[model samples]
Target chain A: MELFFQFVSNTGFYLADYRNVIMIVVGSLFLYLGTAKHYEPLLLIPIGFGILVGNVPFFKGFGLGIYESNSVLHYLYFGVVTGLYPSIVFLGLGAMTDFSSLLARPVLMLLGAAAQMGIFFTLLGALALGFLPKEAGSIAIIGGADGPTSIFLTAKLAPHLIGPIAIAAYSYMALIPVIQPPIMRLLTTRKERLIRMPELREVSKKERVIFPAVGVLLCCFLAPASIPLLGMFFFGNFLKECGAADRLAQTARTAIIDTATILLGLTVGASTQGDVFLTGKSVCIFLLGAVAFSIATASGVIFAKIMNLVLKEKINPLLGAAGVSAVPGSAREVHLVGQSEDPENYLLMHAMACNSSGVIGSAICAGILWSFMVGL
Target chain B: MYGLQAITAHNGWAMAFAGALIVFSGLVVLSFIISQLHKVLLLFEKKPVDFQNDLERPDIEPPEDKLGLSLPKQFPADIREIARLYKPLVEALGETFCLSELYEILRKNDFPHPHITLTALRESEILIPDGDGVFTWNPPTENDDNEKVEG
Candidate 1:
């Protein structure tokens, strides 16, 4: 019996360290959030499970280790850290966007520009908090609420901050349904909310075909840092709209993106090991992230209001708030809120224009950040 | 030898990791702010382009009548060009003797409306509603109500 007790005490099987137990619990929480709460589950579930598997303690009998340098996560991090995966994800995003609404009202492009104010103001705020300049920049990107762009930029400039910044961006994006409406209501009156946009005229197929190529050329020439990510993105979109490469375009948008998302999620999740997480600064980064997202949404709406004052024809100020990085869903949120107020308020196409332009705008923002970091 | 002391010792790597993440997030935020401010400042330098003038311009929007509705010649010309693309499906649906089936068949072919397809069939005296949920289509001048099966 004394020998048996010694065996149990010496054997590091199960709960060998209570910290691993806690980490497992945290990982399970992520799984619940993904499966039950359905919060970005495609990414979060794999990430959650990766965390769980990465933290599993003392499995030496299997002759395997938990997240050693040559582990599965290390290889996954290779793509994420090198900033290759997110750019491919961006290619899928560009294929999914339709910029016809923005082209119809080119002035709405200003809202896309204005919505980025959140990122800048939050940067200054992060800097004032005494963070190193590069670290502060990565933290501020959480305001954009665009996960891939945030990840791409942080991977280049501040790879260490990738986990927290990504978590912040995705978390706020999921919470947009909760976060955006209050700010939107506080700024706009019932009259403004009820303002129905006049019907948008159809864009010619010729224009649609031309828009993607021209957009890629112009943006690439202006901000070369944006080329690799934005270039593939527009190329995917151009293939889609060009009306000939349907098979290849469909495969890129659906199959390629779906595969990458799984690999990316697992990799990102595993990177958030207990040894990497559970810090005071990570909490601070999360708090700062919520602030940046709120400010960006508000700034976008305010710019639309400003535009209305200067223009004769009315635009729904709500669509402007959709300028943050969540793409069609954020824009759809604006439309849904407007639709709740008035069913006749069909702002989908208009909101889509701003939302799609945001894909370009945010990538450019990422490129600019990369350029500044590299001093290109 | 256990608990907090053990945790602190084990967590040296975590602390380093958190420090690195914080630094990276800070850099992205900084770049975003500078680039956006640059664009905003440049806006003032340009002449304020009038939204109304742009709105009034015909180049901005197509004629107002085309909202939500696709142009008539657009999908049809393309469909006829590739009618062979849908020929097998068309042959399959013709075997199903229900208006709902026919409605789906027409829609799959991108006929503008499902009702229009039924209406055209009725005007041509081809489809006769059999008082039940089903529809019987008669090839013109044929008297036999034959339930013919196609292999």
Candidate 2:
């Protein structure tokens, strides 16, 4: 009877705090968003479930928490901590990515570069908010809206902030459909949204094959710190475009990337314990992340409008909002918005050009931040 | 007061300007290189054939199927019969057809397998989906035309 009472007393119900309860509810919200809303299900489901697992209030000395040494979760989390998962994810992304749109319309690459205003501005915000430079740099990358890049930068510059930063980055990415349309609408007129882009010129096979090689060389020469992420990325693209390694390319994009994603998302989620995650700093990070993302989206759209003044053939400025590197998600959102304005306006391909360029641009920005902040 | 002090304590404005400049410079250089790649490849005498004109030629004969016949062999026999039945309608529709419009033509002509025929045409690379249930016919290549003449 005494033992039974002791067991009952030691249960999670007694051990759980208000913060733990809040985190678990937050996790459930993630699960709901992923499952019911179908918003980034591949990432959110694992992350949500991991949050539940992490917040269960197990004995700390029992090697149960993700941070505990010799724990299985710790072992899995090593990839995230060492930045292996993001690099591998980049490989998969490179293999699956079709850079034809970017190549066909080289000028749209500027929108991708211009959209990175969010990252730097957010960096300043984070610093002003009393974060150390490293922490600030890590926080600012959430603006780029590329989850892996955010993880990669945080792991390098501020490992302690990885959990909140990754969560914030991914939350914004999943909310692209919700968050972006308003900014796009606010920035552009109906006529501007309806402006149709000309058809993209065909990119030859030779051009496709040469791109990964030249791209790596050019990008890496400019930002050597980015070589780890960008190298794997371009190598994966080379595998796909070179025509000699179809099987390797297929495996990288499918099986390898899927495995890495599951591990990265779950470990990242599990890292966000109530004790680690429910701090004032975390709330600030989330707020700053939202601001950064909004600024990035706005900057892209506004820049496209500016560019329209110089060009003879006007571009649909809506494509510029796709420059924040949410991959096909942001591009798809741009298309949906354009379609709502003019059903015949097929901006998907042009938007994809901007979106893919955003991926490269953000990775470059992450490297720049890493170079500046890592040592300081 | 602390928050306000924190915001002003760093050289964020300078860093922001420099960072934006670097990103712009790097990508602009990349853009310039990519814009020149086609011209450079052309100089090396490895030019991609212009398919725009070839794709517009309605007078060119469609290639034979794997069975060495004039129609696609991979398609169901019923779909092939439907294609034969609606040849004039297809010619009139030009390069693209709406699935519903194609179905209407098939129904009016008393042909079967409108859905199956559409799917088969896509699989056979004769029709490319142009989104929104629209499909465009693939233009015959010079190689396809040469093969047709040889056969």
Candidate 3:
């Protein structure tokens, strides 16, 4: 009878609490959104499942929890902790990215740079909210709207806050369609939204091949700490453009990136254990993340408006909304909004140019943030 | 921890200001370089007429891609190079072309694997379908002179 009682006590039901229940519910919602709504399904599904697995109540020290040193989950998670998975993801992204649009319209890259102001502003905001500098930096990068970058910087600066920061970053990224449109509409006039961008020029093979080499040298020289992230990105792009390493480029874009993404998403989800994640700080992080995204979007649009004052070839200010590092998400959102205003306006390609630059901008900011912390 | 006190005490203001400046400058310089990438390629595209003194020379050597002639491995011909090389020929055959017509021209020019190279051009999107079993070449730009050189 006592043995039966002990067994019952050891089971999850007896040990489970309201926090665990809430986290499990949140995990289920992620699964539902991924399966039904298609909000970043590639990411949300694994993360959703990982969250459920993480929240399962168990006695500590049996090598079951992800935090347990000897656990298999921990072993898989070592990739995230060491920043390996995100780097691999970046490599794949670089190979897959067609920089032709960006090269065709170089001026749009400034929108991406302008958008990164969210990260710095949010850093100050987080600090003012009482988070330590390292923790604040991790929270600030949520503004970059880059999942891998958010994970990479958080892992480096404040390993403990990885769950909240990553969840916040990806959540906002998935919600780009929801979050960006209203702000984009509010910022730009109807005429600005309807403005059609000029056609892109054809980028030559020589120019394509040289960009990665030049880009890597300049970015790394300025932000030496960004080498790990930007280095892999440029290398993958080089393989694609060089015309000699197509096979390697195929693997980097497909197999390698796919593998890294699955691991990264799952580990990041599991890291959000209820007790650790359910905090005042987590709420603050979420609020700050929203603010960061809004600020970034606004900054990009405003900068484009500012640019139009000088240039004769007025840019469609909607392209500026794609300046956050959410890749196709922000770019697609910009396109949808533009189409809403002027059905004939095709802003996707131009938005993608800004989107690509946003990726570069965010990676640079991540490096700068890390260097600041290291200097301290 | 609240207001300017918190932001100032940790030097958040300085870091934020510096971070924003560096990223903006980095991107500005990068954009300037990207705008110049094609112009730089134009310089290399000019032919080396000094060495090719043989007026009767067949001119069979592949044009320099600006990466030098000696590659570590013998890879397939570049898509852009293939596109550039065949573009003028396709243009001569008029606005739209059937695959067989282009293949005939490549065969007359003694191009190795005319069939395979055409397939590659189609695959790389340099050749766009124009319906009725015909295709149109992509819009030409100044950079279209990727392989063309005047002797």
Candidate 4:
């Protein structure tokens, strides 16, 4: 009878704290958003389930928690801690991405560079709000709207902030549809939104083949700190475009990326324990991340407007908001907005140019921040 | 002057400006390289022949009628089956057709494994290769068609 009473007392129902219950609810919300709403289900499903698994009450001394040294979850988390998964994810992204749009319209690439203003501006905001330089830099990359880059920079600059920064980055990425359209509407006139771009010039096969090599050289020469991420990225692109290693490219894009994503998402979610995640700082990080994303989207739109003043052909300013590197997600949102304005208008390829450029630009920004703050 | 030290020391405004400048400059350099490289590569490429216009050209001679052609005697069962299915469509497409056009036509008709179908037709001597990946349909002879009808 005494042993039965002890077992009942030690049950999760009795041992659960308010924070644990709150985290479980938060995890459930993520699951609902992923499954019902279909917001980045590939990432959210794994992460949401991981959060639920991590939050289950366990004894302190037993090595079951993700942070515990001997735990399986902790071993899986080594990739996040060491910044390996992000680089691998970049490789897979490169294999899948087509840079022809960016190459065809080189000037649109500038919009990508301009959109990175958010990262820099948000760094200032973070510093002003009293984060240390490294922490601020890590938080600032959330503005880039690239989840892997956020985790990579945070893992390097401030490992402790990885959980919040990654969550904030990914959450905002999933919310790109919700967050970007209003800003895109407020910033541009109806006519500006309706401006139809000329068909992009065809980029030759030779140019496509040469781009990754030249890109690697140019980017790495300027900022060697970006080598790990950009180098792998270009290498993957070379495998895809070189026309000789199609099987390698296919494997990199599909199997390798899928495996990395599952591990990265699950481990990142598991890292967010009730003790680590439920804090005033985490709340502030989320707020700052939202502002950063907004600033990046607005800056891209505004910069595209500014570019129209100089160019002969007026660009649809809506394509500019795709410059935040949420990848095809932000680009798709740009297309939807443009379609709403003009049914015949197809801004997908144009927005994709900006989106692809945004990926490169943000990676460069990360390298610059890493070089200056973390000394490469 | 705000520089690397300022960024290292957590000078938010300085880092912001510097970071923006660096990102812009690096991408601009990359943009310049891509633009110039494309232009340089274009100099070496021969002007691409417009295949659609070539197909429409009146000067090219029509392929000789191949109505008497028969499937190879040693053709595999799979190849023969595929050839049988594709023969009517090949005849409907007329004498000469682009491989891609035929693939699309087969796809529109919901034909399974168009590539395999095309390969099988080729192996059965029903599709004779013309220049530039185009093919000429070589229909079975009247005797073979009549044999099939009677048998």
Q: Write the per-residue lDDT of candidate 2 for residues B1-151, one digit (tens) a residue.
A: 2354665555566667788899899999999899999999997763333454455656867764222224343433443444454566667777778878776665444344454456666776667789987787664456765776699
Per-residue accuracy of model 2 over A1-376 as CA lDDT, tens digit each: 9999888767788789988999999999999999999999999999999899888887677888899998999999999999999999999999998999889999999999989999988988888778988899999999999999999999999999999999999999999998999999999998899897765766999999999999999989988889888999999999999999999999999999999999999999998899889999999999999999999999999999999999989998898899999988999999999999876567888999999889899999989888877557
Docking quality category of candidate 3 according to DockQ thresholds: acceptable
- Candidate-wise lDDT, in order: 0.69, 0.87, 0.89, 0.86
Listed for each candidate, the true contacts retained, as a fraction, are 0.00, 0.76, 0.88, 0.64
Docking quality category of candidate 1 according to DockQ thresholds? incorrect
Report the C-alpha displacement of residue B62, candidate 4, in angstroms.
16
The DockQ scores of all candidates, in the order shown, are 0.03, 0.33, 0.35, 0.26
Greater-TM-score candidate between 1 and 2: 2
Write down the TM-score for model 3: 0.83
The best candidate by TM-score is 3
Comparing 1 and 3 on TM-score, the stronger one: 3
**TM-score per candidate, in order?**
0.69, 0.82, 0.83, 0.80
Give the lDDT of residue A46 in candidate 2. Answer: 90
Residue A219 shift from truth in candidate 1, angstroms: 1.3
The 10-residue segment of model 3 chain A with minimum total lDDT is: A196-205
Off by over 4 Å in 2: B1-9, B46-89, B92-151
Clashes of each: 24, 2, 0, 0
| Candidate that scores best on lDDT | 3
User: Candidate 3 — which pairs collide?
Assistant: none
Candidate 3: residue B50 Cα off by (Å): 9.4
